[model samples]
Target: MPQKMVEKIEEIAEGSDDGLCDVIFHLKSQDLTLTHVVNAGGVAFRNRSLVTSATELLPPSLEVLRERQPRTIRRKTDRDAEEPSFASTIARAPISASPLEETIARNYDRLATAIASAALRPSVERVKDRTKDRFRQYRPAVLWSSESLRVALRRDDLLDLRQRTDFLASLNDVYPNQQVGVPRYFSPARSSAKVQGELSRVAWGVERVGAPAAWGAFGHRGAGVRVAVLDTGVDASHPDLKGKIKGWAEFDGSGAQLPRSRPHDTDRHGTHVCGTIAGGGHSGQFVGVAPEAEIYAGLVLNGRKGGTVAQILAGLDWAIEQRVHVINLSLGGRTLERVVRSPFHRSLFHAASIGISVVAAAGNDGSQTSGTPGNDFFALAVGAVDVKDRCAGFSGGGTHLITESEHIGPKLLPLAYSKPDLCAPGVDIRSTVPKEAWGFLSGTSMATPHVAGAVALLRSACQGFSDLPGFRQSSVIQDIILATTFDLGERGLDHRFGFGRVDALRAIDAASGWVTDTSEYRDRRNRSPVAPPSARGRLGRLPGIGPADPGA
Candidate 1:
């Protein structure tokens, strides 16, 4: 009786050359009929009646074809003689039940009919409504500079305020430094012989000494390690990073920079971070943390060092989908949001929950405020420490802070924590930049990825460790890194240096459980000799062993 129902039946009939439609139509009168018509492509034939009934037909007119049967049949005997004829079949016979059951069943049948009709009609209205609802619920908060806003507004006038450039520019433009810098030591073309020589002589930190030193120590070089750098996009075609760079996703809808086009670094921050983590050795020039580790680059921020929460979220989601083992987020923002509640935080937590370690910069604000992604417990929040192994003056201090209605107690606020978890050579550190251009910049941003690169080395050394069941169930990697640090600041676990300066060589030695101890003893002749313990265990414990079990 409904207009939509009629249209659906007509469509089905047209598709079948006026043969009985797959769906059955039942009216209050309980009458049924089967009509047939013939057509030759564009040539049409008048409708011809095959069978008509005054009462409900015996098979109820809803028939499904057998596998071998042609979809359309011209003769009735051809269908009736087939295996399991519809006439002998019995479908859902009316059941004598309670009124409620009858009503429910009737409604369900009606709903199914409506669904089938709408699907066949192919209306875009419902899809449009869903799209609008999604936009309303997840509208991203944009943060851009005034110049960017003007460009965006001029580009599209129909966009709503939330999508408009003027509105995004009005928000706080907190993040600056968006360019990648080239170190003064870097040159585009250094001889391969020189590069290999530097690689052999470079004083890798204690932790990194083993993997590069031993062949097949774990797996073959660069077999399964995956390091994803989520920052500015990478130069896919860079000669040094050709096949080594894998997987890419773009969230920036604007057609400014693409995968093939390497955007000029406005601040050199991302390139520096990338170089530190996995810069390929070019000629005899700069090398990265894990030179052989496979690198995946994602550009979340634009050239201006500004992006919406949505773009960042998209980048994170893409990274997780790639199943990267290590994610380095060398950026931060001030927020006390929980990963469980915020979508952005939730995305990061999801990645970590699946065994991917996320590392983030504490912040450069020089306040006690921990930034958003860094504040997430799922991430390893790294703070800056100077060359003297003292907390950098610009590093944030941690103290008790209030958050929401819940009186969350004291914890190390990321940037403001009195003592950083560990210190690294943050001042005058060198790394990579875009346009083959490199420079040096200072901030906690430069320090975070150092730990990420260290993790990559550990991952390489402990082949198949991540794949083992419950490998990351404990804080093995975290404790090993802390125990290997060389004390530099005030005392043990002071505010300036949480533990001590990161010693890569020491860390590698610790991983192997090797230690060398020196102790002074008085002899019978009133003579004393200082005998240092070998790089082995002492006092019934391993040399690298600390108060707490590193593997535990």
Candidate 2:
């Protein structure tokens, strides 16, 4: 709805006639409370909010989230050439929301409810967590986010206080309202076949993503890169992962960092992920995507108890500080609403800004959208595909809501931005387990490591890819990966296949001085000047990798 805005003169020249001000604005559109005002008492602007209710009038929807998007026009220049014109000079309709407003609008409902509920809670600690040890289960919690916003939510109002956006300026973090969990890869446990050479020889996932072909041609297996796996700790002593664990840390159930913690794997998940990433493949066991990538394992998840959002955040912060080439988070949280922006959204954005590739799993809930973090647009979210290129039934897929802020939505199949960035093999995959053994497990979790390992390989093969300005580096690598995929389910980028099942050889070919080929991905990524001189005249040269191209 168009608001009834009352314009106020914000600034006036010294003793100007009739107190003239250039721009007029309204401090508050609702309640007309003018708590935050401009040009008041000789002050340029003053924010004095005595707001009785901080709640926005309505919840944001995908339909209205684009209100703040600026309009652009092609204007004729001196040489009759067209140049893009900004909305400000072109007299287009004004964008309704600002970045601040967008965040507030999207989160107002949930926060309001949390605040209201908190006001009624008794000031007492609970005996147990809301879901007990089942951290993967979704529940309501209240967390404060960003410094400017203050939540009146009572300490006990929300169950997960740490997950809330912190009200104190000391901690400027966005938080979830519930405990988040690493995606569960629990299927029936593997039998002795996990130990014998039966299922251990060749990782089907590595082949599914075209890793072997890349190995044969490019001869790069992620030797010069570092990868951070935030999960249950890895078994450093496992033969296949004997020397893969480089840096190690553990987080308590409360998510506190134990900087000097020892490497441990109470459960098999992280070890399996490690094995799939850089396992030595001794004893005929199939090797991981990037077998030689250094691994930094953050023991965020507990063997007996599931993981928490705070632990994940701590581990991620550590990884980003380490500046590892890629960070893989094979976990997700079931969200309450379509317009949710969990706290990790900001964290993921930070990692991206610094040029780190943070890959996460599209949840296994099989819901309409993927969970938070993975759903975040900045993270390289992955979905699960089988050897046959079929989308897994348990693999999460749905439509994601896209907003003008460019914050990514879920990786579900229904909406535009909600689909997984890409798909990878996630079923019946074999990798090293406890006791120097091998095992089979499945989930978007399994699929996520494939992409993470591939990133290590890509970063090693193409130094130029990571050397770009931090923000552009990940995009270029993503473009390369997306550019040379084997489209499945749908022809182009879709909810199921994402960019498509990742093709390692094609990605290697593109990164290994082969981008000059005439493929869609290469053509799109081949920009001059923006790219280094070494990249000039190198794109769109080779024949495109088509559906039936040899070795495709």
Using lDDT as the measure, the top candidate is 2
Candidate 2 C-alpha lDDT tens digits along 1-552: 011111001111221233211111111123111111100100100010111111110111112222323232223332111211111111122222223334345444544443344422321122124334643222222221211122212222322333332321123222322345556775655433432333234566775676655655555779978899998899899887888789998876444576567898978888988888888555545558888899999988876777766566667767866778889888778653565455565456446545678888888877466777777746777899765677988777666543322211122122234457678888877787888887778888999899988888877776655434444455456555655566677555566766577766666655554332334333333331022232212222312211111222
- Model 2, residue 183: displacement in angstroms? 2.4
Leading candidate by TM-score: 2
For residues 160-257, write the lDDT of model 1, one tens digit per residue. 22233332332222121112222111122332442233333231221222223322232223446687877766664444454667666555532122
lDDT at residue 220 of model 2 (Cα atoms): 74
Instruction: Give all TM-scores, in the order shown.
Output: 0.51, 0.64
Worst 10 residues of 1 by lDDT: 39-48
Off by over 4 Å in 1: 1-223, 237-242, 253-267, 335-344, 400-420, 470-474, 490-496, 513-552
